[model samples]
Target: MAKHNIYKMSVSEVYPHYITKAEKKGRTKEEVDEIIIWLTGYTQAQLDKELEKKTDFETFFVNAPNMNPARTLIKGVICGIRVEDIEEPIMKEIRYLDKLVDELAKGKSMDKILRK
Candidate 1:
C-alpha cells in the first residue's frame, strides 16, 4: 500500500505544507496558525474556528470596516472597541505600510519581507 500525501489530508491532519528544508523548528502547523491569529490580535476561540471566511486588515480598513477579523477578537478580548482606542494600532500599521511605500519609492533591493 502507498502512503497518503499531506495535501490530501484534512485541515486537522496535514498542514503548513508537506515539505521542510530548514531546521524544522517551532510549534505544530496548527499552533503556528493560531499564534498568527493571536499576533494579528484574534481571540483564542475566534482563532480556533476554521469555518469563517478569511480577511485581511487592508480590505477591512478600505471596504468593510465591519468585517475585521482582528476587530472581532479585539472586541471579544478587550473592552468595547472604540474608534479612538483603535486609532493607535491603525496608525501604526499605516505608518508601517507607508514606510514600505517610501522604501519601494526609493527603488531599494526590495526583499521578500518588504514584498509582503
Candidate 2:
C-alpha cells in the first residue's frame, strides 16, 4: 500500500492545527502538549526540539523515547475511522494523538483523558 502523504509531513506542520482546535474550545496548548508527551514519552524539551527540527510524522513516532503501552487503550472513532482498528502502525499512532486532542477539546478532564 502506498504510504499516506501525512507520513512525510512534518509534525510541526499540523501541530498548530491541533493547538487551534483545542484553543477554540478553551483548552490550552499545555494540555495538547501533555497528550503528546503521554503518548510518545517525549520530554517537553525534546518535543520542542523535534518541532523546531521539523521532524516528519513517521520519524517523530519512530524515534519516540517510550511509546506508552496504554496508548493501545485509546479506542474510538477519529476521522470517521476507529483508532484501535487501524492496522498500520504509524497511522494508528497518529490517530491516537488525534483522539486524545479531540477528547481534550471536548472538555474531558485531564485525568480521564489521560486514562488514569
Question: Candidate 1: which pairs clash?
Answer: none
Please give the lDDT score at residue 33 for candidate 1: 42
Which regions in candidate 1 have their CA more than 4 angstroms from the true location? 1-87, 112-116
TM-score of each: 0.25, 0.98
For residues 1-116, write the lDDT of model 2, one tens digit per residue: 79999999999999999999999999999999999999999999999999999999999999999999988889999999999889999999999999999999999999998889
Clashes in model 2: which pairs? none
Candidate 1 residue lDDT tens string, 10-86: 33231233112111532243434432333344454553443233433343223321322432222211223333344
Return the top candidate by lDDT: 2
Off by more than 4 A, model 2: none
